[model samples]
Target: MGHRFPAIVVLGWVLAAAALSLLVTPLGTVVERSSTAFLPEDSPTLQGLRVMDTAFGSGDTQSYVFVVITDDDGLGDGERRVYADLVSTLEDEPERVSEVQDYLGQPQARRSMTSKDGQATYLVVGLRSAVGSPASDEDVKWLRSAVEDLDAPPGTEVHVTGDPAMISDLTTAVNEASLKITAVSLFLLVGILWLVYRRVTTVLVSLVTIGVALLCTRGALAWAGEQGLALSTYTDAFVVAITLGAGTDYCVFLISRFREEYGNGLEPLDAVAEAVSRGGVRCSV
Candidate 1:
């Protein structure tokens, strides 16, 4: 749309962008970073997993988290008490927890699970959800916070780490990194455009066009996701990059040509319309 159409069109776009941004958050609910089914069908990992499933139930069905309690001096009554309390709290949730293997009153388990110098002890927590699933991630996060909240005696350190913890932390890092990249990219885009065009109006117009396009695309993706469109967590980040790249290219072409047309004696609206027609045809090719 040209400056003529934009008398109302841009306002419509701005309003639509504001409204559609709300739908974008829900799209995050469908975006998943966890799923252990990423392996190739004939891979050795898959083969081992199949064997495990046959022998001792599906490894894919249960997630595990490790609670390691460490001390430089060695295990003590304080450490054992902390482990016992955590086990009791975790066992309260039957729906979320499948088993909590505390090394209490079991000589064999304690011997095998403890470090050689007796400096560290650990508990194996089995969760009902599959590995890398959302429920499993939540359970791991909850366990981590719960263990940290315990009043362990001095010199005892509790840590939660394992397959589920790794997945949860990785996904969290990806999301935070995506947001940082997007913000930095936008800020740099504005600075670079201002340096090139040297016109405030020009810079704003181009970004507004790109922003409107991005918001519209996000709204469409969210709708498609609700209709069963499968997308990765990286989809949002990819969309931002693609939209900025393509949108900025098109905007540059149109604005530069519009300035040329205006200098050649065309009216403002006529120049924009001509720029759009010319830019659209060439960009498509």
Candidate 2:
């Protein structure tokens, strides 16, 4: 096999890597952390929610991002006006906001929505989508950007916090952490392989092959997802660990054997063949 079509062998791995790279975004979409994901379809809770949804048109609880407006000497004119303007802005942009519970003007609800000192009051902004949904994530991003540049009193602060916001934040955090961990793991693998092999070709080849293998595995998993395979959010993290660890171990075994065969005065191609027949088979099994 080594004597026949070496270029095809290398090109196959390269093309696999490219295909996986293209599927990365679609793969991310398939990993859902929604409340509905964990609930069984026939469960009482799911059935109840479905019934409620049919009755009320939306069983999903309205996600409320509390916008607290405050000042040093209690709610002043500027603070009140800012709160009103915020409510007006949300109301004007019907597409972005589903509802804005203007607790700012409702004196009856002041006790429940305001701080004990009367300096702080909050507005509950209802989201258009349920938490963990794609629509909910888009709304969260829009809400964040909308409030980011709001004109308010000198000391008045704005924050968007709710289930939707939290879910979006959690997803972003997990993705970032996974990438960082994967990078560190690969870096350490390369360093260790370099020290052990004492040859650039061996280290580079092993690492590149391992990377290609990992990409191929992930791409296959992504394709499964496309075909209605439901996977947990932790799938990506686990795949990264398993593929890298197993690939490195197998590559090391094969490379060590090849080195041994070459030291015995065998040619490069012959050494590879012998290494595959010995170490590669054991690694595979």
Candidate 3:
């Protein structure tokens, strides 16, 4: 009965895809992208954070600083003012900032803070204990803006970079790169499918089937994660690549076999059944 209706088969797939998309779209809310996701749950860093949180009523906060250089002359008058202003700005935000250390003018600390060329020195800003431990995106944005707002002399420059900055930058980079990679992969898939099939209808059908496979795989993974599975953040990209590559290959194989069967004088529906029986066995193996 189903073999007599190929349009019905395609429509069934279309309807299934529509339903799966509804379920997967909302799963985006539960998707997590944190350091804890990448690290072992029993790792020392996680253990240390828990212990610190218990003992201190919150987790430990990190202090970040910049090694500012005014000119080639080394920690001079302008550079010293830049250092002082940085300290003052941080101190003013006592809620977010716990301490500010300026070793620029200190007699004993001056040598350590200054570079060999005497153009650079470090200004440390201690983040408050109750502040975001692994600073949130908003926190990082605020920190950057505050540092950029500081007035500096002609040769002076301020740099706010450390572990927090690096982590924030890494997260941003991963997101952007994943999107570009996915787009490029899809574009290439369509081009390759067209080259292999030649017929526009065949290529379109192949793409539709690949899309359905990806949606179903992502939806299943999202459901598993919701049910307490520890799915990694990288799983999405991995799933997309695997499903599309394998799905397109299978589609091409089956379509080619159907065409061969029809060319050998089988009826349209008979050709489909023959192709499925043959290709399905190969896929199952």
Candidate 4:
């Protein structure tokens, strides 16, 4: 039984890790290709613009808005110089960019640029690519840096806003948050087990068993994936929670019975065997 438990734990952990890797690899591919991760491919209103295309053709294109801040006095000589510099930069990149409308240069575009107090100027740049196109990131980075490079009038600020970049940033933040949560939960669970058992060996054994159970569960998921199952991103968390909780519960039952037998003067090995028999019967029922 002792040898069996350790072997079971090792095999389970290895299988779980393999299964998780398999499931995650395919899921990552799907997320990137299907436009379901950082940016979606299809728009409800626009017919042809996919999230994957950075260049816009016959369909509606993705837009990036640069908000330039200045004093309420409006575009003075210094402000005009800044605007000219930005315009020249945009004009030089005609191949990558379609149109650049600055409030200071294009009076018609000024309607959209004017803030409530007229302290800020907004520039709308149209890209040649569609929403999720590779060119979109480059365009956004170029525009933001260009505005920042400009010698703005005193107290001026520049900020870039758009859906594509924002969504990409959101995905990064969510992944980080999920990782932190998982790490904290694992630490807390280990601490709780240690406190409940007060024996290093007991706690370690419990963790090993639970770990094996988790591996088995993940292996099951991986097999499902191989059979063409569509797993969600949240499936990992669900499987981990169910496996760990159930496995730990089983460990506690076994350990409790073992302790009871030991108190009655049974040898350690005999107590463990008796505990396993009792725990196994109860668990199976």
What are the clashing pairs of model 1? none
Give one digit per residue, the lDDT tens place, for model 4 in 206-235: 877777666666666655655566554445
Taking all chains together, each candidate's TM-score versus the true structure is: 0.77, 0.71, 0.67, 0.56
Which of 2 and 3 is the better model by TM-score? 2
Q: Judging by lDDT against the true structure, name the best candidate.
A: 1
Residue-level lDDT of model 3, residues 228-267, one tens digit each, is 7665545666677788779877887888899999999998
Error of 3 at 236 (Å): 4.6
Evaluated against the true structure, the overall lDDT of model 1 is 0.76
The TM-score of candidate 1 is: 0.77
Ranking by lDDT: 1, 2, 3, 4
Error of 3 at 74 (Å): 2.9
Candidate 1, residue 11: CA error in Å? 6.4
Model 4 whole-model lDDT (C-alpha atoms) = 0.62
In TM-score terms, candidate 3 sits at: 0.67
257 in model 4: Cα distance from truth in Å? Answer: 10
Model 1 — which ten-residue stretch has the worst lDDT?
Answer: 32-41
